[model samples]
Target: MTGLMAGKRGLIMGLANDKSLAWGIAKALADQGAELAFSYQGDALRKRVAPLAEQLGSDFLIDCDVSDMAALDRTFDALKARWETIDFLVHAIGFSDKNELRGQFVDTSLDNFLLTMNISAYSFVAVTRRARAMMPEGGSILTLTYYGAEKVIPHYNVMGVAKAALETSVKYLAMDLGPENIRVNAISAGPIKTLAASGIGDFRYILKWNEYNSPLRRNVTIDDVGGSALYLLSDLASGVTGEIHHVDAGYNVVGMKAEDAPDI
Candidate 1:
C-alpha cells in the first residue's frame, strides 16, 4: 500500500519552490515510489526545479513553455526519447498579470484575458494532447484549480474565469480520452500561501476569511492538497474521471459566512 506508485513514472509541471503545491504533490508521489520528471518554463526555474527533482531521485528536467506550441512539442519529444510512456501528468501551471488580479473583472483587458486563458486554461489542453499521445495504455491527468472558479472570490478576476474554462476542458478531455481508459480531473484547492497566491489582491484577507468560515475552521495547506492529489492520481480513483473534486475544507458548500466568524 505504501508503494502505490512504485512502478510509475510521470511528469510534474509548474514547480516553483519548496512551498509550491506541486512540490507537496511531488513529495507525496515520490515518497510512494513514483519516478518523476519535471518541466520548468525558464532557466531560473530550471535551477530551482533541478534540486527538487533530484530530491525525489529524478533529474529529468525539460524546458517547456506551454504557451509556445514548439516548446511543448520538444518537451514531449524529450520524454519520448527517455521514457517510452508515462503513467500520469501533473499540471500545476497558471499565470495572470498581477496588476489585473485586483480590481473588477470587467476591467480585464483583451490581451491579458487571452494570455491568462492561454496559460492557465488552454495549457492543460495543450499538455494533455501531448501527454495523451504517450499514454497509449491510458493514464491519469490532474490539474490545480481553485474554488474561485465555481463562485466569486473578490479579486480572483480573470484567473477564476480561466479556471472555469479549465474545469470544462477536464470534462471534455475526459470524454475524448475515456475510451482509451485515460482520466482527467481537477482539484479545486483551498487557500495556501504559495508564491502564486502572493500575487492575488487581499490574499491575506481571503485566507483569514476561509479560516474563519470554512467548516474545518482553518485554511488548507499543500500537504492537505497533496494527499487528495495522490488519491486521484492513484488507482484509488480508477472510477473517477472528469471530476472537479473539492479539496477546500468544505468551503465550497457554504451559502453564507459562519454566524460566529469574525469579520475580516
Candidate 2:
C-alpha cells in the first residue's frame, strides 16, 4: 500500500550499486514514504551509492568502515546531528575475501575468518548498539541473511558460518532490545546476482539449481526481497521479533531436487 512507511526515517548500509539488495530495499522503503540515509565504505562506493541515493531522494550519505568501531560511532554521531531519532534501520552488509569464498571451510584462514565475522556478523551488533541510542522511542531493525546460514552451500565457506552467527545475534539483539519496544529481525534471502554474490565461486550454478528446485521454480529478485523487507521494517510486523523470515522462493523447505526438474 502507499505510504506504508509515511513519516518514518532510517539508515541503509552495505549498498554497493543499483543491483544491490540494499538498493531494492531502499527503493521499496522510499516508495512507501520513508526518508533514507545511506552508508558507504569507500570513495569508489560513494561514487556508485550517491546517484542511487539521489534517485531515492536521499542526500544523506555517510562513509564509514563497519570493521572499525570508531568509524561506526562517528557514523551514528553524524546521523544524530542530522536527525535526533530514527524509526528503523536496514543492515544489508556482509563480506569475506573472494579467495576464501571458493575453498573448503576447513581451509579458511584465521585472518579471513575474523575479518568475515567482524564485517558479516558483528557489524550488525555494533550498528544496532549505536542505533538503539537513536531510537529512544523504539524502532525496527532489519538485516539481510541467507539460506547458507542454515544449510550448506558449496563455495559459501566462512561467510556461511558468519551468517549463522548473524542469525543468532538477531535473536539475542531482539531479546535485548525488545524490552525497550525495539524489534529486531532478519531476511534469509535466496541467491540473487548482486555484486556481493560475484565473490562466490560457481554462483551461477547455485542460482540455476535453486531456480529449478525451489517450490516456486524460479529465482527471487531484489524486488522480491524488498517487498518482504518493507513489511518487516514497517509497523505491519510490530508483533514480529527474533525471526528469521525466509524470502527464498520457498527453497528452504525443499529437501530434494524436483522430480520434474532437469539437472542444472
Candidate 3:
C-alpha cells in the first residue's frame, strides 16, 4: 500500500509544466519512493522543469532532444554518471505542428508528416533502446498515447497515425526485450486540457463530448493517469507487457453517445 517504488530510480522525459501528464506520472513515482531524473530539451524548459523536479526532491536534469540520437546517447551517459542502472523509464513525449494538427489528414504535408513521426513516435523507439542498456536486470518502460490512434477524431490528424506507430512499437519492443525481462507498454489516455491538447482544433468540444458521453460521464485527469502509471511501472504489473492499457475512463468502450447525454 505504500512505497511501491521504494528502491526504484528512473528518468522522466518530456515534462513541460505542472499540468503535463509526465508531471502526474513523475509525482506518482516519486511519492511511491522512486528517485527520479528529468530530461528537458532546452534552457527555456529547464527553467520550468527544474523547479518542478525540486518539488519531488530531484536535482538531476538532463538536456537532450529525443529526435537527435546523439543527444539521447549523451542523456543516458549523463544518467549513467549518477546511477549505473535504472529500474524504469517514463516516456511522456510527443508533438506535431499545430498547423497540421487542425487540417484534414489528406492535406498533411510530407515534411510535417516525417517531422511529426520523428518526434511523436520514433522518439519512444530511440529512448527505449538507450533505456534498455541501463536495465540489465530487467525493467519497465511506459509511454503516453491517445485513443485517437484507434479511432478517427476530428483534428487529431497525423498525430493519430504517429500514435498508432508508437502503440505497435510497444508490442515489438516487448517481444525483443522480454527474454531479457524488460517490459514495454503504453497508456492510451483520454483527452485532457494540457499544453499539448491546446493545439488540436475544437479541442474544447472534444473534451465536452467525452464528458457527456463517456461511461464515467466525465473526462480523466492527470492524476487518474498517474495512478494507472504507478501500477504499470511498479512490481505489481510484473507479469504484464506489450500491452496498450486504456486509462480513458471507460470512454473507449462506448458504442454511441449516451442516451441521456447532453449534446456537446
Candidate 4:
C-alpha cells in the first residue's frame, strides 16, 4: 500500500493549514511513501506550511506566490536542481475580492474580475508552463475546481466564470502535453469550509442545504477530496487526463432535491 508512489515526487499548492484539502492530499501521498515539496503564498503561510512539510519528511518547501514570475521560476528551479524527473504537480490556489464574492454578478468590478481570473484561473497556466519544463518524462497536473464552474452557485459570482475557463484550459492543456506523456486534469470538489469559501455570501446555508439534499446525505470532507486527488495524481490514473473528477459526495449529480428535503 505504501509503494504506489514510493519513488514519485511532486509539488502541491494552496495549503493554509492542516484542514486544507492540499494538506490532506499531501499527508495521504506521503503516507503512501511519495516524497513531496510544498509551496506557500507568503512568509506567514511559509511559517505554517514549512513545519508540516518537514514533519512529513519534506525539505522541498519553496515560497511561491503564483502571480509572481520570479518566485515561480525560483520554485521550479529548486526542484529541477534536486529531482531530474518528477511525477505530479498540484495547483490548489484561487482568489477573488471578498466584496465581489457577496454581491450580484453584474456588480463585479473589472479589476477584480481580471484579478480573480489571473490568480484563480491563469495561475495554473503560468505555473504549469514552468513545471512542464522540469518534467522531462511527463507528469500529472491537477487543479481544484467546483461545480460552480458549470452551474451558478449563488454568490459565487465571477469566481464561477473563472472556474469554467479553468476547466476548459485543462482539456486543451491535456491535448497539448499528450505527446510528451504529461497529463492534466482538475478535481471539482464539493463545498468544504475553508478561508476562501467563507468569502461567499450565504455560505452557511449552502453547506447545510448541500448536506441534507445531496445523494450522499452529507457534505464532503478534506479527506474525501484528498483521496480523489491522490488517485488523479498517481499512476493509477495514467489514462485519466483532461477530465473533471468530482469528489463531492454525489451532490453535483443531483437535478433536484428529494421530496422530503427543505427548499432553498
lDDT of 4 by residue, 17-41 (tens): 8878898789878888889989888
Per-residue CA lDDT of model 3 for 54-102, tens digit only, reads: 9999999999899889999999999999999999999999889999889
Which order, best to worst by lDDT?
2, 3, 1, 4
Best of the two (1, 4) by TM-score? 1
Off by over 4 Å in 1: none
Scored by lDDT, the top model is 2
Clashing pairs in 2: none
For model 3, which pairs clash?
none
lDDT of each: 0.94, 0.95, 0.94, 0.88
- Model 4 CA deviation exceeding 4 Å by range: none
Q: Model 3: residues >4 Å from true position, as ranges? A: none
Worst 10 residues of 3 by lDDT: 1-10
lDDT of 1 by residue, 58-112 (tens): 9899999999999999999999999999999999999999999999999999999
Q: What is the lDDT of residue 33 in candidate 3?
A: 96
Better of 3 and 4 by lDDT: 3
Model 4's TM-score against the true structure: 0.97
Span of 10 residues, lowest total lDDT, candidate 1: 1-10
